[model samples]
Target chain A: MDKLLVSKRMKGRLVQNAILQAIFFFATVLGLIALMLLLSHVVMQAIGWLDGDFLNNFPSRRPEEAGMKSGLIGSLWLMMIVAPVSFILGVGTAIYLEEYALKNRFTAFIQTNISNLTGVPSIVFGLLGLTIFVRELGLGRSVLAAGLTMSLLVFPVIVVAAQEAIRAVPQQLREASYAMGATKWQTICRVVLPAALPGMLTGAILALSRAVGETAPLVVLGIPTFIAYLPSGVLDTFTVMPLQIYNWTGRPQEEFQHVAAAGIVVLLGFLIMMNSVAVLIRNKFQKRF
Target chain B: MGIPTNQEQPFSVREMIVENQRRQHWPKRMEKIAPKLLFTLAALSVLVTLGILFTLLFETIEFFRRVSIVEFVTSKEWLPWNEEHGSFGVAPLVTGTLLTTGIAMLFAVPIGLASAIYLSEYASERTRRIIKPALEVLAGIPTIVYGFFALTIVTPLLQNVIPDLEIFNALSPGLVMGIMIIPMIASLSEDAMSAVPNSIREGALALGATKLEVALKVVLPAAASGVIASVILGISRAVGETMIVAVAGGSSPEFTFDVTKSIQTLTAYIVQVTTGDAGYGTTIYYSIYAVGMTLFLFTLVMNVLAQYISRRFREEY
Candidate 1:
């Protein structure tokens, strides 16, 4: 009887453990289901709106006829401005902090503040953009203001990522360069940066992905909800994918909702593509290393 | 050794002096200058922080002057664009943000913590590898997609379950936000839990503790600091989340605690007000900065608290 009781208890414990593991497995599966459902719903709702003219023309008051040409162009323009500027500023700061600066109180303070700034809400940056870029600087409600605001939003993330990438470069490589009589600047430019480039690029892509989807900062920077014409210059008033989708989503018309769904599909597609590329780069770098 | 002839001599005093000066002076000068330049570059990070604070503060102060601090803080109404009268009560927006974040935490903490426990203690190596990357994929999904999911799918499902739910209420958005933030909490907490030494679990098992008991009593205690920090960071994410709230949460800025009602958050309000209504220098416009300042302070405090807790109480073993 004692032996039977022990065996039964052991079986019970096994069943319980199996159940617990199954629950966790299900939860993870549920996350995937959520993502899949979102993608499918977008595709289903947006199918009718995916025509040639839809991509070619600017937005119109008529939902059936409106396209995303201007918004797409505006987003491209914003990217052109934000991407390089953020990459340079963020990567430069990271290199200085990680490779050059002494580990002291001042550097520690700056590091802590950078992390804190990363936690600052994007809308707050929008407010900063409104006051400094839009009003004080007289950039007006233009693409330049939006791009500047977004650059601030992505800057901290890029800096953090770049710092990690730079730190990952082997210390021995730096010493080798120095022993070979390379100056500090030459060592960084030639040895450290090339080794860290892939990681830095991964961060840049991630940051840019975030910037592209950002709606709040752009909204606060006063991006127009309705722009019939393509933005012509940096100072030209603009609308981005998020703002355009937002405008359509808020409309009462059913057709407009369809258009909004289509816009979301396009936006999500772009984001997914960017992320996949980052992953590819990361994997390639890992293999090379 | 014999001395070289004058024609074959290495250098005269004048040439030697010039060569020595060129080699010694400029490099020493550059070494002195390089660090200063690099320090300035690092200092730019601090400058960025200061710039943001000063800009937000000045604009917010101007905003508060137009709308009294009392009205802004205490009043429940937030009608800034009305012609006859405009109210600047920020209470509802604050409440909405808190309520949604609270709901998000409720959903995220349990599932996320459990997942952490499972990954750290229960899962096989292959399962762990697969699940970890899958969770990261969840994190990689943009917030905009989450917004759409909340708006289209979650809202409809919630409406079916809870009668009287508005088209854009707090429940769906908060729930979706929780899902979006789960990877953050789970990943951090998993690292903390995994950091607990294997000896603790072995000792607990030797004492005849069940797997669950070992996980809960032995491992979790060791990882508490990390778990708490993860939760705080999750809260910060929920608070700062913009696209999800702005898209799904309604624009009705009311100071009510009802989760079923349409409410606006500080982020959603900033989006709404800034979209087209307010001119550049208008008081209505400066209110965006005021709202943003409040948000900035809230997240800043949370981040500082999380950092302090993690740094102060982090366990090495």
Candidate 2:
């Protein structure tokens, strides 16, 4: 009787384990399914809408004539400002914290501040851009203002990535540089920077991709969705791919939804290209240590 | 070892002196200025925080100057576009934000935790590589796409089932927002679960515990703080989300718990006001900052709480 009872309890436990595992498995499957559905749905909507004219023509009331030309160029202009500004500031900040700053209350505050900034919603950053850049600075919803806003938005991400990369450079390498009578700057420039460059590049690219997809902060900056002409300079008014897609998606016409899907395909194409570049950089320069 | 010859010298005396002066001058100036430059860059982050604070604070003060604080908080209406008889009570918007955030948490937590558990505890190496990237891709997809999906696909699908769902209801956006945040929870929780030391798992298994028992009872408890932090962060993300709600959540500011009806969130309100002509210094204009302040505070509290919980309860190996 005791043996029979013990075996029965064991069977029950086994059944419970199997059931729970299946539940977990299905949960993961659900996420993948959602991804597939989103992709397929967008692709289906984009079937005939994604073409050369779609990329070349200006946005219009007519769906067939609407193109992302101004948006595509405007995005490039935004990147021109965002890329250098964010990279220099973000990497410089990381180098200061990791290589220079002593561990104390001040550094601690900076660290906490950065993490908190990361948590601040992108929309709040939009408010900041609206007040400081667009209104106070008189940037007037221009590409430069939008770019600066995006720079601040992605600043923490790039800093965190650079810090991790700097931290990963072996201490022994630094010591070797010092033993050769190198100064702090010399050691950092010669030894640490080289080793950390690839990681920093990867991080910066991923962060920039995020900038490319960002629409909220730009919307808050009052970036117009109906710019027919491409921005000729940084100070010119601009729209981006995501914002264009948003404008399309919100239209009452059903055909505009397909245009939005096409815009999504293009925007996603850019993001995937950027992400794969990051991945390529990581794989090419990944050190075993 | 032989005496150095003039022909073997790589530089003339003038050249050597010039190079030495150049090096000394450049490095000395850079060594002095580089730290300060970098420090200035680092300080920009603090300036950003201060900028956000003062911008929100000043505009919010301007808003409160026109509207009574009591009415702003206690009243249930949120119509600010009507210049004459517009109501500014934020309660309806708060309720809308809460309802949507609640729904999002409900949908995300279980699926996210389960995926984390499956990835960390059950999946093999190959399966994990495939599954993990797939989830990352989900995370990487822009929120605008999700907003479009919510508006175009999810709402229609739900309307078919519920038959009473509005074209722009809270349910679709909330669920889609939940999907947008699942990766955050799954990735962070998986990191926490994976950090659980191997010895605990081994000990549990040696006691004849089932795999699920070991994962749930042993690893889950050990990483509880981190798991909680991820959830709080997810909540924060949902609260701050603007595009999904702005796109799919209807613009009606109503005080109702019914998920089938249209409601306006604080973020959606800000988008509406910004996109329209609120004009500078109008009550409608300043009200955006007031609403933003509310949104900012909600996210700030959640983030601080998450940070506190994670740091306070962190278990060291």
Candidate 3:
């Protein structure tokens, strides 16, 4: 009788285990379903609208005549400024905190401040851009202003990633350099930077890709949606791909929504390319040591 | 000591040391300069924080000069358009933000925690690898796309079932934002759960506990602080999110708790005001800064609280 009771209790526990496991499994399934729906829905709408004309022409009142040329060029110009500036600033900050800064209140404050900045809403950064870069500096919704804003927005991401990469460098490498009587800069330049390069590059590329998708900040900068001319310089007024997509999506017509989806496909294509390059750098160049 | 003997003069160490130091003088100068330069770069981040603070503060103060602080805080309406009869109370926008965030959390916490539990305790390494990056892809998709998805697809689908839903209601954006943040919460909580020692699970199993029981009672408790921290961070993200709400959360500023009705979040309001030609120095223009300051404070408090919980309640091995 005791054995039968034990068997019954064990069976009950097994049943409970299966139920909980299924529940957990389905939770992941739900998220996957949402992802799949979003992709398929966008792609299905973008089927016929994504063509050469869509990429070549400027946006017009008519859907078929509309293209993302100015938006694409504007985004390109913005990245021209964002890529170099953010990389230099981000990697520099990472190197300082990891290799140079003494452990003290000031360094600690900078670290905490960076963490807090990452949590600041992108729109707040937009407000910052509007006030300082746009109004105070008189850049006036130019690509330079937008690019600098995006750089600050993505700065924390690159810094944190680069810091992780720098921290992951083995201490033995630095010790060997010190043993050879190498100065701090020599040790860093020779032993540490090379080891950390792949990770740093990956982080910078991913951050750039993120900047591509950012729309709210650009919108808040008051970059008008219908720019007929391409931006030739940093100071030229510009609109980005996401902002174009945003404007299109907000329109009352059905064709504009489809056009927005096509724009999204192109934007996603760029993002996928960037992300794959990041993965390739991580896999192909990362040193095992 | 001053003069070397004839035998030692051929290899004088002092002369050689001086020659090498002089040869590397440029590098030595650069070494001194590099730290200061990098420090300046690092300090720029602090300047950014100060810029954001002062810009918002300066304008918000200007906004308060026009409208009393008490009326701004206590009033229910937000009508910056009607400057003469405008009610500058921030309550409607705050309520709208809270409503969307509440709905987002309601959906995200359960699914995200469940997915974290599955990934940490149930899935094999292969399944985890494949699923993890896929979820990250979900996270990587832009918020603007999510906004489009909510407006174009989700709303139409929801309208079929929930007939009372407005064309641009809070429910669609709230639900879509919930989907957007799921990956964030899942990945963070998974990292926390994975940090729990395997020995704890072993001990539970040795005591005749089932796998579910072990995960529920042992690992979950051990990783409680981390999971909570992740959820808090997710809440902050939801609170600060702009485009999704701006796109689908509607533009009307109303003081309603109903998710089916049109409402405007603080972020959506900022977008609305900024996108319009709110001429510089106008009440509407300054109001964006005031609204932005409120959003900034909300996110800052949540972020600090998350950091405190994670650091304070960490379970060290």
RMSD of each: 3.9, 2.2, 3.5
Assess each prediction's global lDDT (C-alpha) against the native: 0.84, 0.92, 0.93
lDDT of 2 at A124: 93
- For candidate 3, the docking band is high
lDDT for residue A196 in candidate 3, whole number 0-100: 99
Give lDDT tens digits, candidate 3, residues B110-224: 9999999999999999999999999999989989999999999999999999999998888999999999889999999999999999998999999999999988999999999
Evaluate residue A224 in candidate 2 and report its C-alpha lDDT on the 0 to 100 scale: 98
For residues B6-109, what per-residue lDDT tens digits would candidate 2 score against the true structure? 67444678976776687589787888888899999999889999999999999999999999989999988887876678889999898888888989999999
Candidate 1: list runs displaced more than 4 Å: A1-11, A287-289, B1-37, B79-86, B206-208
Worst 10 residues of 1 chain A by lDDT: A24-33
lDDT at A9, model 1: 89
Prediction 2 TM-score vs. true: 0.97
Top candidate when judged by TM-score against the true structure: 2
Best-fitting candidate, measured by lDDT? 3
Candidate 3 chain B weakest lDDT stretch, 10 residues: B1-10
List pairs with backbone clashes in candidate 3: none
Please report how far candidate 1 places residue A50 from its true position, in Å.
Answer: 1.6
